[model samples]
Target chain A: MSAQISFRNLTLGYERHPAVHHLSGEVKQGALLAICGANGAGKSTLLKGIGGALKPLGGSIDRHGLDPREIAYLPQGAEIDRSFPIHVYDMVSMGLWRRAGLFGGIGRADRTKIEHAIAAVGLEGFETRPIGTLSGGQMQRTLFARLLLQDARVILLDEPFTALDAKTVSDLVDLVRRWHGEKRTVIAVLHDFDLVRATFPETLLLARTPVAWGPTAEALGPENLLKARRLGESWRDDALPCSDAA
Target chain B: MSLFDTFFAPFAEFEFMRRALAGVFALSLGAGPVGAFLMLRRMSLTGDAMAHAILPGAAIGFLFAGLNLYAMTAGGLAAGLLVAVGAGVVARATGMKEDASLAAFYLISLALGVLIVSLRGSNVDLLHVLFGTVLGIDDATLMLIAGITTVTLLTLAVVWRPLVLECVDPTFLASVSRSGGVSHIAFLSLVVLNLVGGFHALGTLLSVGLMMLPAATARFFVRDLTALVTTSTLIAFGSGVAGLLVSYHLGTPSGPSIILVAGLAYAGAVILGPIGGLAGRFVPRRHLEA
Candidate 1:
């Protein structure tokens, strides 16, 4: 019952231009895959394409039997709306939006899940607080609470640790490890190389195209990293391989 | 007299008064929910533009059909929707902000409406187009209001969740739903319908104010969507009554008077609202926390 995602010749971006051109890749069921790239290198765009936010500019993407709703994506922490007054409990409950009947009302079981998700993210006491009051780290934790409530088999995190302190980052890493161990596919757009090596078993490096994708140890090795850095401009070609460079 | 007798006295006196009251309620019902979404989407001005853009449509309908209320109303709705969609497309195509485009559309429509009316054979109908003063409220107008409210409400009920999702977090909604794009289109269409229907009582110039101010006032007292919608409806209806009574006593136009009443409510909310930007300075943080 493992979840799998496949991208075939997928080119993603705006209607006028393509960002990730003709890139193909896959995440095996239950793999913690880190997507790392420089700014504007199509890391976020590729994640959005996989999560079905951006329709591919060319080719196709198939998520074998897995519903898009069953995929949870935590956009960059700062991108969330904090102004309108809403409590953490209700925010967490939104994960059940699709699961709630067409009329969209949450039931008792859904409430229990919301509470459990809040507890999972160590936000037990903060359930009723307005989401706007939360610190940057706390907001990220609340987002995690929401994702956990979704019970999605696939978790896509876009730089979830950007504004957090070092301690919070480690704690988040532990949570990702726990999720990975439980057979959930975790693909995150991460900037921190150390965190990626420590937590993720696989890595997908991109700079407008797939530069390297493989087991974490091989992909993050010194030789492969150098190749990835050098291939920054011409990464769209896809003719070169990290293994060959090594 | 009992409080009810005083407050509800106008309902008993004249048929026109009753129709006017009914018209207010119908307009509020559609405007309340539609306005809430507009505020959520930060497109309050879009409602403003739609309100104004309907002018030419109403004027044209009046010119061609000559006081045929239904035809005029239909013309206004068609023109309003056309301008709304056109503005959206122009914004998308040219990298222009929607509000900026809407402002241009409103000006063009308003001018065209005035120009068309000027060239027409009758100069008498111009009064209804601008002020919407009480000339003679007809059963047909009531029916029109009721029909418009029903359609707007039914469509809103179906698309409530998606529209809300789209407003609160479009990126998240896009990730979860298979048809996010479709839901967005439907949401905008409902807004257009609601604005077109409500355009009669408030006029295109002030319709957005009526829709927006009540909701803005309600936001001071309520946090959840259900409470917010209900409170806004009450505020709108109450303001409508106040405006109607003021106009009845002073012999002023109903539309402007009603808008002034709602504007006062907005001022009160802005001063006394829990998280009122200015009022926040005086109130303690714990008191304002939702």
Candidate 2:
């Protein structure tokens, strides 16, 4: 398969302290890739770099043919402010931002897509409810509906299933599978190993640097997992910078 | 006195009261929506800070033009924009929180403004700048207030979608389009412009009260953006009229009376409103169950 995204000696960090260092890999077209690591292992940071939310500290990220607007990124739930007075339908309609834009009217066809997306997420009757009034599961479903409407060729999810109940997880995992079936490139930062092993065909294990990459079973082997944990534990905040020439 | 004599008579009989009514009505039309966005964005205190930031420019205007409406308005707008942009820069460059930077800048503005006003102008001029001369508004000032209201409403409508997107999910907005930063700057400009308009009618200190109190009160009673803006405007207008009547009867200061009435409205909404009020705690909320 052709590469959808290629990272060459990429480094991403804050204040020049790399969270993801010297990462070189390619996410193939129509692949479901899971990024797994311990806390502070740069999973989310890597996703952010790919989503164009943050600039790389060093190296380059090449998107083969996809434009930046064709990528949909779902940030961690904690990053969103739910208390803002917005209806679930209005929030979901924001997925059409690329096509409709800020001032463009949502035509009848777009409205139908929005309604269908909402129903697909089992949130049909909750369309007009304020986002603040929804439960955690319901809110996640609402966001999933939005993602459905986004219909991006590349979807990046940052800890999408964290704090969700089992049923919600199963439902959202189904959606992720549907994305896979549609031949979209999907990259997700995930913590739960069982879920990742079961759902994602490709796995990248990282601990500030790539420990293993390739098929899920080999990349997440016991030896590689131990190496990742050791690397993560030995990391020092004030360590000297690694030589770029090396 | 009958209801007509108490409420309607003062506005009908006195030209000053009539002008004050027109001035506040115009102020509410713009300030209401602006303030609703402020509350939604959790920038209520930023609104307060920007209100103080306009002081030095209006003070400078007073020094040059001796209470000239056009001069004060222009000066206030300049000063407000300066502080807004300056605070944003400081926050970005230094990684300081925007609120901390805004507070620092506004404090300096307030001090400089007071010093400039007290340096040359009389106490009465300071009182007019600080408390406003709502009862003393002339045709020129009234027209300026109305003109600002028109501009504010139009600009708000134009930037409405992006601004709402910015407030709800800013990262999402940034991902989809380049209008996120533009929308933010535009929203801040609207806040400053409305504050400038409000300063002419209610003075710097109480102007934010006219904006924030009604907006906050409206939030307690409504769960949608349209309803919030509409309710806030109605609250502000009602407070303006009631405050004028109370001032007419009780011989209180007009601007303070108007703000006091708005404060009272907020308190009443907190107690009696259906959404999240004290009364709402006792009564089971049905709408939130979905």
Candidate 3:
């Protein structure tokens, strides 16, 4: 299968200070990849670079044949404002944003799709409830419903299971499996090594740079995990800028 | 005097009162929705900043046109847009918070506006500019306010979807489409336009009062965006009517009276509103137990 996404010597960071440095990798079509790392691992930064939310400070992120709109990105829950007065249905329907756009009407077919997505996430009666009234798990479910509606070729999930209840995590993990089964490229930043080992077929352990890559079992070995922790600990604010060469 | 006579007679008898009422009512219609969005985005104070940002522009217009409505409106729009866009750019480029940059710019703009107005116009003219001349509203100014209100409402309708998305989840909006940036700029422009409109009716210092007070009040009453906007507009309109009546009867300043009435409504909602109100807090945790 062709690579759906390729990062070549990519360095992404804020203010010329690299969070992710000289990372080179390819995500094959329909690959289910979990990115694991300790705190300050640049896992989220990698996702942001690929999702085109942040520009590459050095190098490039090539989106093979996929258009920018063909990718769906779910940022961390902290990035979303739950206090805003928005209905669950309305927020979920925003997944169709690329298709319906600013002024486009949501046709009956789209409405049906939206409804199906909401029902699929076990939020059947939450259509009219304001998002602020929802619990964290319910809100995550609503966001997943939105992602389902996105129906994109590449889906990037940043810390998808953080702070979620076990039931909600398992249910959303099932959806992720379903997406992989549907032959979509899925990349997620995860902290749970046990969950990654049990589910993800491929894993990338990163700490500012690639520590290991390949099958989950081989990539997440004890040595590589320890190295990732060491790399994170040694990272300093005044560290020398990373060069383009990997 | 009868209640009807006290409330209706002022508007019925005087052309100026009727015009003032119509001007502020239109202001309420547009300002309420924009203000609700501002509050939702946590940019309520940005509205205040933008209000001050328009002052130097309006004062420049006064200098050039000598109280000409068109000149002042155009100038205010220009200045307001400049400050808003400038603040946004500075925030993005330098990593400073938008509100901080907006504050810096607005304070400078305020000083410049006062200095410019004082250089050309008298203290009386300055008071008129700062406090507004709602009772003295002419047909041209009235038409301008109505026109701005119409444009604001229509633009809001067109950008409503993206605007809500941008407010609630800007990162998601950015991922989905390119219109997120467009929606933000368009929303800020609408805010500037409405502030200019309200400035004519309520003064630059108090224009945000008409937009933000009713919005803050409505939040206490409604959980849905549609209900919040509708309730806000109603509250603003009611405040306009009540403020006009009070001003007419007591011979108080119209603009301040209008804002004061809105403030009073906000206080009432905070105390007695069903949602998150102080009184609601006292209603007990029986449901929590259940």
Best by lDDT: 3
User: In lDDT terms, how accurate is model 2?
Assistant: 0.88
Question: Which CAPRI category fits model 3?
Answer: high
Give TM per candidate.
0.87, 0.95, 0.96
What are the runs in model 3 whose C-alpha is more than 4 Å off? A233-238, A241-246, B117-124, B288-290
Cα lDDT listed for each candidate: 0.76, 0.88, 0.89
Which candidate model has the greater TM-score, 1 or 2?
2
Interface RMSD of 2: 1.2
Q: Order of candidates by lDDT, top first?
A: 3, 2, 1
lDDT of 2 by residue, B93-143 (tens): 678988998898888887987787788755535566778878889999888
DockQ-wise, the better of 1 and 3 is: 3
Give TM-score values for chain A, per-prediction: 0.87, 0.96, 0.96
Instruction: Tell me model 3's lDDT, rounded to 2 decimals.
Output: 0.89
Rank all candidate structures by their TM-score, best first, as comma-separated numbers: 3, 2, 1
Q: DockQ score for model 2, please? A: 0.68
What is the TM-score (0 to 1) of chain A in model 1? 0.87
* lDDT for each residue of candidate 1 in B1-290, tens digit (9 for 90 to 100): 57666667767877778888888888888888777777767887777677677878877887888767787788787878777777776876687987887788778877887777777656645557556643255677777778878988898888777776666666787777755555555666666666555656666676677789898888888777777888888898888888888887688888899989999998988888875546777766664454
Q: Taking the tens digit of each residue's C-alpha lDDT, what string does model 1 give over A38-131? A: 7777888887877877777677788998877678988876556676556788777778866873486777877888898888777889987877
Across all models, the iRMS values in order are 2.0, 1.2, 1.1
Residues A1-246, candidate 2: write the lDDT tens digits.
899999999998888788899999899989999999999999998988998878898998999877776799888887678988889999999999888875689999999999999998889899999999898899889989999999999999989999999999999999999999999999999999999889999999999899999999999999999999999834567788778824
